[model samples]
Target chain A: MNARVTPQDSALIRSARFRKEREADWRRLEDLVEKAEKNGLQNMDFAGTRDLASLYRQATTSLAIAREISLDKALLEYLEALTARAYLSVYAPQERLGGLVGRFITKSAPQAMRRSWFYILLGFLCMGLGALAGYLLYLENASWFYVFMPPEMAGGRGPDSTTAFLRSVIYDDDHSSSGLGAFATYLFSHNTRIAIFVFGLGVFACAPAFLLTFYNGLILGAFYALHVDRGLGWDLGGWLSIHGVTELSAICIACGGGMQLGMAVLFPGRNTRKEALRLAGKDAVKLAIVAAIMLVAAAILEGFFRQTVQDMWTRYLIGWTVGFGWLAWFMLGGRARQ
Target chain B: MRSPAADVRKAQRLARKDRRAERGRAASTILPPEGVPLNLPVASIGVRLAAQIADVLITTVAAVCLVILFSALELTRPQTIMAIAMLLFFVIRVPYYILSELAWNGQTLGKRFLKIKVVAHNGGSLSTHALVLRNLMKEAEIFLPGTLLLTLDQESPVASWIALAWVAMAFAIPLMNPYRQRLGDILAGTHVIHLPQPILLKDLAGEAKPMTAAKPGAKGFAFLAHQLDHYGAFELQTLETLLRAQDKFMSPDVHARNRRTVATIVEKIRQKIGFADPIPPARAVEFLRSFYNAQRAHLEQRQLFGDKRADKHHAADETPQ
Candidate 1:
């Protein structure tokens, strides 16, 4: 032993020795992890699972020590990756898709809606007031209809358009299937855009959401007045009944979500604003999801059934059914558990 | 025993300190939260922006492809075609972001490319709702305002100004925040961080080959196993960074800078671990290097024997003898 063993050389020798001692356990852990990755955790028996967990704990400890000792970067990195992968597999949520969707529908959405009922009522009031005001304004002067409905949107349904032309536009089912598909897509996009806008803008203190809700009601009111003036009020009712029940309610629900968000920011109560907002967001998001589902149902009705249904009575029946179905679901859904 | 409330307060205080340290920019270290043992670095603004740019490009390309496919179908109504195209853009494009983030574990293709990932702010697994909400908000935060601004030529003057203001606020929010979080991240309680890069170990002994054999009584310092047990992974990583940085530069100023840094670290480690060895100025780097190797080996050896070490403290609960 003529050669001098400096501290650096000794440290290297010690590290190499450590590697030799632990190499078998590391190799076993690596094999287990590889098998789990390839064939899923179910492939491992109870003992194997336990061993994997124990190995993971040991590897994490090794990582801590390696860091303390300033071990080789490569060794440290290997441990880090292995530990992280194991942690993910062990701790990550493992809900099946069917279960997740079922839970959301059966509990999450309805419960959220119930929690935010106050905001929903307020949204309804806002829309009602706007609709009444619009009806009265349109009754006072026909020109107010133009103010509420844009020319592009009106599609020649302005005050200047004849009653017969308006009637034909509503009753005509002569358009190509492609045209109907395009229209359906367009209406779905437009409604979705507005719903998202109201929901998002609610974060800005709920004013925009309220205003948008009011604006939507005003359009409906003005359109109703136009139909009444043409002596086709029943026809208009039938026309709106098929899809309006679903579409309008969805908008209202989305607006409710917006108001909920706004109120959280404004009030916050005992919690910090961030905490309050986070809590409110959970309920608000569920309301938005419910609103989206309604919109999809509405789009389907308008696209496939609205034009095809010739009898006004059949249309009203379908519309009222959907409207009542939703009402029942909201009021009674998830109430069994409570 | 500390009250639960006191524990909560302590955690909050630590969190605040960590946030403050992150804002300092010059502080290169990150301290994990109470339960989370990993210390991941937050991604830089430049990397985040690059990732966002990549995502935008992908979306645009997808939109263009849809438009071309629709046009080639030779539909009778151009208005109908345009409307359908717009509809597809919203329905498909929005979900693309949500699903990508969810499936890829908080990483979109762009984020993957930049090696950054979104993680829960509270150090929990990401939830589906959080993923959906954040992506949905992207419409309001970036896309809507951006599209409005780009179409300024067609918009009313008042509307154009409002759009401009919205876009400005969206762009500025991330810059002003310590975590560089956009409105979505703030609302969703998520933030992006840089993924740890793979580390390759170089042979430390091979590098020390130039040293001559030790003369009699010229003993190099050796750290006792107990002395090496004080520091943990965090300190080890910090030292590794310093060593790596030393090898990255060749300029005289950089060398001088590295020497100063190494000396400061050596002194800090000595004080921390209570090592009594008087390391000569020239031997400070070498001494730290040797200590690092020895400590790392000792830790690994302990781990194999089913002994665990969490931090500096070798508590009985953490590492049973």
Candidate 2:
């Protein structure tokens, strides 16, 4: 209703609309460009807007005459405006902040998270179950508990299997060098990898991922419960958390990917669920790639740092520091600058 | 490019035609006609491009921030905890956007900042389920044959070529529309629109002046008679109030008082103008436009100067010039 149609006003809606209209024309354009490139047309200079419009019009008219055109007048006009807007972006650029802010606001904050929460929680719950299952399996044969802890702790001890097991989990045989650092590093990486698996499974992936997650969870729970029963829970908890924070975040990312896929499959909006699932699966893979990096970092931390620190207080300090550091970095750093 | 002069002339003619019609209607009857909203203005190429750029920058920053937060936990902690944290963030944050845009009329934080809204072509907000469904459709929006088309060879199979063709078409739907749309919009039967301020009385006055000068068609006269009969005196007051207090106008509820006031005025106007003929809404608009312009001119002139004094001053001003 406004008396003007400024090129500026039509920018945002153009790309999507252009894709819809002239589907054939766009394909043709891409084809022509590609063909031209193949034929060494890269350096060929083209004319201005007038030429492009005429060419486009000719193509569109031919399609219309052949009764092959699908777009209506209203849609066509919309597409034209959008196309004009798109052309401007290539020639005269805008600030990057605008683009960043737009994506953060539109794509990341709410909708993406909502679509992916279920698998995350499921992954968490599965880990606990996994830990518990491991515990029960250990209890079935008490003599085998030492074997479950690791190989090194049992090396020197002829009796006192419990002592041997603790040694293997927390320290080395030499006692000159504590294994706490190594164990911590291993735990961080191991947990993160497990988390990744749980998350990346998606719906089909989610099932196995969840099972693995639950199995790990149960093992952790049972191991801790056993330690508490022996009055070593505090030491264990402090020792474990040093790298747990980062490792856990990685796992959650995996679960997030899985959830996205599951949701896509379960609720495909305009398309069939199968199609949705396929798309979600690809995105999940992208997510998993990122998750893998986190898992690796967690592994290094667990293997090196956690196992080396012996004093419970010192361990707690390091654990809290890393945990809070990550928290502050993610939640506060970007926002504080803004 | 099209001739700038031609475009300008065409726009002016359209404006003039609208103005004259408005004046004609106002002169014929005391009652004013209901106003129609203007078409949504298209977004410029620059803004659309900015929107894309914004999306990428925002996601990267957010991801970086999330990574930093996850780094703080002690190495000794169970790996599962980090896993949980990641899962929580991803699940809660992602879909919230898609749902909000679909349900609240395409207004996520970014869209809201951009000042655009989505609605059904028929003009209504989407429901929660529809919003949920739309969000889920991101799979298609993000993936689909567009990617495949981009990668395929020129001499691909007919089916492959056809698929590429289909996605290409889907993508263009929005551009072809006054309201830019893509395939999802077509499938969902929705449109995006820009909301602007209401039209002013001056603009209306300018539009109406010339229409009343033309010879009246029988259809126009008949419509005028209908307006006078259905809405007469009271409709005038309501319209005047609307125009005078345009800045402060709120959508008043249709209670008996308002309904009766408007109805009585409409009836009076119809009786006075006697526009009872079968003319379309577009043609009928001409009469009201002319009437509005004449009325506006008369009122402005009266307010601007006292009759004799104003004329003597005008003569003096002309003499000095």
Candidate 3:
């Protein structure tokens, strides 16, 4: 036991003693964190949870103290890792199921929509311009309809189609073998995939978002032009109005959401592109999810109401009501609380 | 391929690659609100790829299972069945990634298997928004390119070239970044890091005994303040590592070599610290272990007064022989 102890040995000895005293708490915290990580914090009792929090705080303070003193690497690293793991466990985002969903409905989604009114308007205007161009081009020359609309997608509907054929295609209510349920689900899922793609690609400077929305509007205008050429335009309008109002708005909102991403990258303002994108993503995702929900609603109307109700006035009434309802919801919903 | 020369060259290349890879394990220093700097070892690109491959396999299996389930449903109409299968193909992968990460605290099944996790770059809680954004970009980064590659041969030359370029860029994004972040991680402000594993060893404060012989009452060497000041925490840790190693389990030949190494280190420390005491051959390790304890205690205690002697290099010119 012959060793030269220095004047500072008391302080070093105190740190060693400190490690010995606090190690048990650290070990307990590690065990609790491991168990909680494996089987969730909810699995732990109230006493255990309180103990975990207290022990975590002690561990963090120990880490801060140990670093300043330049303690042994092992103890220092142990505390660092322990505190990090404990930090993640303690500060985990706690959202109850109903509260999360409720907040999204009443606050997040609508607020997101209102905030990105610029992008939404941009998306709609692009589509509107494309629709106008398509209408004028097809009206000038019948072949312009064929140029804008692909043969496979046109499905035998063209300028040459008779009035009776166009009317039957719209007002028809026969989907027996392939039921409306399957059809609805199919449309919902298909639109969802396109919506997601539009949302994803909008990160690439918004060019694709513009092109896709414009192309979609062109197809819609060409189809409308074909019906108008046969003088069954108003009847076809009723058929489309049943779901088109909600469906088009959804696609536009998806485009807006996508464009939001691109705009963030393009014009980051004061922050870096990544920072702006992350901030924009919070709202963009909300808009996207709400747009998807609208698609689901549109798919329901398309498959059931559009198929069952053949009355033109009733279809227009339902479609306009839905369109106005969405506008009102976007303009007003979730605003009062904030 | 089986020739000895070729195999040797291949082994050399592999060893070199391993060296390069070891250097690539960059650490992200996160200063939490507590103000302690915690170094998180970011996952290497190779491990990340392996995790991705596992995730891709799971997603592919899921897609196939969905196809089978849809087939079993007997939706007789080909069109409806086709639509459902097509939707399931793209839909399953996104939600699989999202739900797993959200459910498991930024760790998917593959990440858990590989012992890596997604962490926020800002050193805070992993946001649900970041998770969704990152996973959503997977569709653009991997799945779309994967879907395109399936029909690359049938596509026109330009389309095929464009598809190949997209595939290359998507893959190269992670490789080009120091943190190995794909476009998704870059945008989402997240990092994938290896889990921290700090194994606190038994402190060698006073545990110095002869390894080969049970020499009781061996001479205890005491280092003076100036002598202990010749080395610092780094040298102390190196000495501790040497002391903690076990030579008993090795063969007689290797055990002799290990003893030689320890003797060499003991002599070096004695020379460096100007210790004149004659340590017996049996107490050579005991001498080294005592010096390690004294040096560690000296370094830590000196640090109390803000004299952080990191290594012997810092002590060379500062203290005269």
Candidate 4:
């Protein structure tokens, strides 16, 4: 009994000494990580941050050693949680407002738009085909207008409406400018919602997204067909062009972004489908931001310019210029430095 | 704005205290970039649903408030007021989800209340790209379908049924998965894990009498070195649990049962290790305490020499005698 007792006494003493030697470093790391989590890491000085990193490393090392040598359950759990909190602190995303906004605008957004060129073109193609179908169907039968557009959306401007009424509706500049704020807000909210919806539904292999964009184009064509029958086709073009170029393109690009998500899943190449989707998601988010910005721009133009401007020539020129500018921006915006 | 801190803090402390006393239940591991597998418990399905409900309530309240505020403004056109009221929650939800998660490190106000958090599934940093992707998916998966079902255009039972199916499918995704990830979580490569409130209790050493302590009416057991080698860390943890639980709060019946259990454990240990002397009834507790301290130290020494006995199986694997 005397011989057995001696080794146990010494073992207990050694374990206590080991813990006492390293406990200070672990405590310091725990304090720093907690402070950084509650506040921000920027509040700490350079020396403090350096010490935190060093202490975190030491704690991890101590934890590894403790696992092998210590039977203390409390110490083991404390070390495990401490390292996890430290890992989160050390690797947490730290985005500065200025750099993020600048980078998103000048780099990421434009680059994503450029990358999604094929999907965007495909979105436009679907829209174009739907437009052609609606236009031909309307020309074949004027009553097809009701079939293409619901009365609520058409706002009583249908095949049954007089040409005079249609023309007056397009050139209704006498509407109160005070209501422009409300109009812009409504349009921005409405279009942005549809854009986001189209983008989000793209994950089901692009069919849903493509079909929705096509459906939107059908409405556009049916409306134009009604004006054509009234011989106000070019006038309708001028009226729509002011905001249509921006709004339509924004919606299509959103479709493109969604389709990219679909494509990533459908054809993940070598990477697993989830990894591919995540990468596509990164690009798609940028495109969604672009779509949102364009929709806002469209809302502003429609409310302030379309409601007030009466000149057809000015309208056509502004529309074409903006369209070309959007095209050029996507093609070359982020590549100037490169 | 309501403080979830005080109440949750208490519950969290008790939960962690229970965790420290109990043996590990093999909580799922998160492999951080440091290559260390941190065992964090994933939030349960009920908890996640409750959190979502809380979020929905908050957002709906905000929406109703917006409706009141917008109507109070008395906009001349009813169209403007109608538009605002109709889509308030839809608009409010997206920004509320994205911005709060971004600002508060992947915790929405609801998540903060429940003490669960969105962590990267691949153990990477919680990126803004991921947060945006996930929350955007939330609209397609949950909000749109949920709203449609709630509105339930009664004329068309078919559309209502479709919306019902969509909502069911959205909810079922999380239930079917190992990580309880909804469609958004799957897309974003993120999962919600329960945030542990780890409070290290004072070690068993604090409870155990020192080897030199000469207690009244009893002498401590002198455990042999080879006898200490009979068990492993797994057994030691179980012993730690047994030693930490004092008889203070136990009911009279429970206290009697615990004493019997401890006596049985002492008999088992004495026979397994071939200890010669008989420990009296008064000294059984002390005998177990000193034995635990000595065995834990012996195990630690062996572990220090890179011979970790994870469980009782180490004897069959290592000592061939």
* lDDT of candidate 1 over A1-338, digit per residue (tens): 02244565443455554444565677677777766644557667898788887887776776676555534566667666666555544443334456767988887888888888888888788888888888888999999999998676688897788999989877877646434455547465556667877887898889989998999889888988888888988998998899888888888899999989898889999988777888788888789889988997888788788878878899999999999998888878887754
Highest-TM-score candidate? 4
The per-model DockQ list reads 0.16, 0.01, 0.34, 0.33
For candidate 1, the docking band is: incorrect
**Per-prediction CA RMSD (Å):** 9.2, 23.6, 6.3, 8.6
* lDDT digits (tens) for residues A100-190 of candidate 3: 6688888888888888999999989988988888887788888888787867566688887777877887878786623543653647444
TM-score-based ranking? 4, 3, 1, 2
Better by TM-score, candidate 4 or 3: 4
What's the TM-score of each model vs. the native? 0.74, 0.35, 0.85, 0.86
B185: Cα error in model 3, Å: 3.6
State the lDDT of candidate 4 residue by residue for A125-224, as single tens digits: 9888888888988999888888879676787899888999998888886766435445546464546667876887788788878888888888888889
Worst lDDT 10-window in candidate 2 chain A: A85-94
Decreasing lDDT order of the candidates: 4, 3, 1, 2
Against the reference, the lDDT scores of all candidates come to 0.74, 0.46, 0.77, 0.78
- The best candidate by DockQ is 3
Q: List the residue pairs that clash in candidate 4.
A: none
What alpha-carbon RMSD in Å does predicted model 1 have with respect to the real structure?
9.2
lDDT string, candidate 3, B1-321, tens digits: 399999999999999898666656434676666666667778888898899899988877887787777668864355566656555755677778987887778888899899899988877787777887788777778877777687577637876876798789888888876677888888788889888865666555623323213554444677799888677677776666676675347888988999888788778877877889766777787777667666776787888888877777885656696
Candidate 2 per-residue lDDT over residues A60-177, each given as its tens digit: 3433322222112223333333332222111121123356446544444334334445655565566655666656765565444454443342343322447447646654324322
Over B1-321, each residue of candidate 4 has an lDDT whose tens digit, in order, gives 658898899899999888753532333577776666777777878998788889999998999897787668765356565555555776688789988787767788899899888888788888877787788778778777776776787788977876777778887888776677887787788988877665666666644655336455445567778888789889988887887785358998998898898889989999999998887766677777788788887887787777888988897886666
The 10 consecutive residues of candidate 1 chain A with the worst lDDT sum are: A1-10
